[model samples]
Target: MSQRKRGPFVSVQLMSRWRNIVGLNVGMGEFLHKYPHVFELFVHPLRRNLCCKITQRMRDLIDEEEKIVKEYEPELLQKVKKLLMMSKNGTLHVHALRLIRRELGLPEDFRDSILRTHSKDFRLVDLEIVELVDRNESLAKAEVEKWREKEYVDKWLSEFETSYAFPINFPTGFKIEGGYREKLKSWQRLPYLKPYESKEVLRVCTCGGIERFEKRAVGIIHELLSLTVEKMLEVDRLAHFRKDFAIEINVCELLLKHPGIFYICTKGSTQTVFLREAYSKGCLALPNPIYVVRRKMLDLILLGHRNTRSLEDLEEIKEERNGSVFRTNVGGRRDGDWIVPILDSYDQNAFGSLGDINDSKQPFDGCESGRN
Candidate 1:
């Protein structure tokens, strides 16, 4: 992720600047030709720079997905409400918030919605900050308490708990040292802290109470991951909020300490973390409409990648009765026409490995394409 935020859409030339993340080993010009369906090239009318944009089909899918999110607005509202309550004085700057809005399935005008629709819970202050109208400090801790109570009952079956402990399918050969067994035992015994609970005296943190900070940190991180479409986020993005959200300086260590709740994966060059409890068998156990839509979007890219259609063939493709695109069979390539259904292509086991973006295959190894 860029340290300085950029919009979801970027000029193809600008994207070329970061070859690593975009998976462009060869020049972008060649790579662009290979995935014309995923990326469409157009000249900026004013700047006259030839740029690439996500296809209209992608924007349509997103529109449908946002509708689903709006349907679940009550759930997402409580989510944002809890986050604002977590902050001091129950306020958060809108600028810092814009980063995770998409992942959280929140609308760009969320601040305004909070005032207009959920006026009882939140308010906008000075057009710059979102403030809580009614603070529910125990909100997060209550959730922790419920989960803790349930897990404690399961603790009697130590063997089952150990064997099935929020399964983390780390990439091959990452050994778990023998001490892991002992550590798991102790970690399970640690108490859950209330988000608003104050700490008196502790030997843990130099910042007054170490345990308190950890509890608060976990609460914030938990809230963030919970709101995301995939209960996972780039660790660097979370680190960006270390000071803003009072997260620990050594965030990796903090997350590692709670293996039952979080898992840090180095699947990509950049580290990402997943909320283990939110996943079961490599897929989201509780996928809402937003995840459903995102999975469809992923299918579109994966499908196009797995089975390429020549540009000449797609050029002849025509619109159908519905807005969905359907590619006609050409040159004995694919069988008949298939509508790109929004819910067509999700693997049940895809999320079993800590929310893998592409469960079917590893990310493209080489960036450049043979195109052009």
Candidate 2:
């Protein structure tokens, strides 16, 4: 006769205690401990009887039991199969047999076909179908991300959307509404005063100093004429314009419409000084008439007293606007007394002869202050 392995030397009391600890029936633990050979003796017959030709009701019961085990003891199916190879009790053996039959009855061809058709990697077959699905979803997600990145870069460098936009709105009680923004844009596009490169270099002067004109200064004016150029240019450009032309000629045209100022004689050393500065700075000074008008207006706005209608008031406004002490009462008394003629009979004769002229020599006294 073949000899069997000895059972554990556990007493009944110890068996009961072990059963309580393992949450098994008290009698079941003791019986299992006392007759370890019973598994080998009865499990095979019990498995054959319970699983063979099972009825529909028995199949349903097994399916329900399998679902419960899957939920609460997911490892039970796998552990029981492994344990069956070593030793088994009728109950555990029956459970394992039913699981094997159910698994075998599954649509083996359909399961394999689905896996092969849908799986991103065949190596993942041992994992649950949900896990395979998740991995494939991740791959699809990666493909989508790649497309998005390509689109972003393609759109980022495209020039089609580079132009600026402004909307038009109609306010209440207002008709004939359109976008002033577009009008402003059109105005910006209008050509600004260019450097004497627009012609030949013209002489420029300031009362205090002088310089030669250059294209760069004209470029600064061009930049100031429009918003797009303004954004691209530097603050230092404004500084350079201020240093070169105390009264920006572009804005001088706008100030001319509003009056009440004085003009000082712009000939002699003053014209020479301005011409010299214009040459050095590479920008053209305004026509003498415009310059005189702007000069008076600036003085009145800046220095003349505050009352809206007094001579001193006009002088103060000019000063405030021009940052210069020069004032003029050139306009007839009918207009404000703010404008005064600065050019004498001699000055007027020289300007009339030199209309749109560029003579470096001091026209008034025919003296050359020389290149300053």
Candidate 3:
């Protein structure tokens, strides 16, 4: 809806055209009506036909998210640069990046704004690929390396274990069968090549054993998720880079196998993989400006129509809609100053484990399990 240039509202007939694409099992009108807090339904002033638009509050949240993205362009640029450096050939397909652009906190015009403006740092090849011109050795460090260093120094873990260990954060209620802990500990102690290390070295080391090869694949995925703004990505989107990253194992199975390090939410039309360590009770362990803005949007969606408004509040919304600019308090804070509080509790049983690879599939509701 935000991408439409005609106006904020779209005709109900027009929106219905995308019902199949959006995977709506019910009528578009019905679905829109269900979320009255997020979508406002009204007759078009000129056309005199029913149309729908995101509520004023939702529009404000979207604008704020865009502003936050613009403010973090510099940091996002470095993140993209580092991602290209971590790639096997110092390049990433344009389409693959577009698939997760929002997760990476990139502006819509990043191609021209970031890549073209910084010609010294990036190059566009045949308009299909983004290649790094100069790889910065300093930026070559993977995020997991820092975690390993911290564990070695702060936690007093042995260098051998810390060097290859990943931070495990098993979801609450995750079942650990007998011998699983010992097996996990031994796997953690196994050495593997880092994601940012040379591919030639990784190729030579993989010949030693399948365990080392799989562990290296895990490190690659861990580094990839850490580079994202949300620390999550669609499972299918990750498959697009399997050949590029040399992940021979089925991506879904690999994630399912390591319940502690990653969580796959099998909710909605797509499967999403979340880095467990990056989240605490469903909220980001470390929130950034962009993430905070997005969280505000989520809070608004969750608010639904249950949020009661007095006459004064309705009048203020009307005045704002009529272009009478003024600040108003929402939930005891000024609209511009509002920050959604982190959720205190979540469903412990929302997360389901396969128990073992041989175990039967279990119901998983990632949305309820991962609050953010």
Winning model by TM-score: 3
Look at candidate 2 and tell me the lDDT of residue 127: 39
Candidate 2, position 174, lDDT? 21
Q: Model 1, range 214-280, lDDT digits (tens) per residue?
A: 7557766776687687788877777766654556468877877664456676644666777655654
Better of 2 and 3 by lDDT: 3
Candidate order, lDDT descending: 3, 1, 2
Worst 10 residues of 3 by lDDT: 354-363
Candidate 3 lDDT tens digits, 85-143: 66778888888888888888898888888888989999999687889898788887888
The parts of candidate 1 lying over 4 Å away from their true place are: 1-28, 40-56, 115-119, 137-143, 152-183, 196-212, 267-269, 305-372
- Distance (Å) between predicted and true CA of 182, model 1? 4.2
Per residue, candidate 2 scores C-alpha lDDT tens digits across 306-329 of 232323233322332342223344
Alpha carbon deviation, residue 138, candidate 3 (Å):
1.2
Computed on alpha carbons, the lDDT of every model, listed in order, comes to 0.56, 0.26, 0.70
Query: RMSD per prediction, one decimal?
Result: 9.9, 43.7, 7.5
For lDDT, the strongest prediction is 3
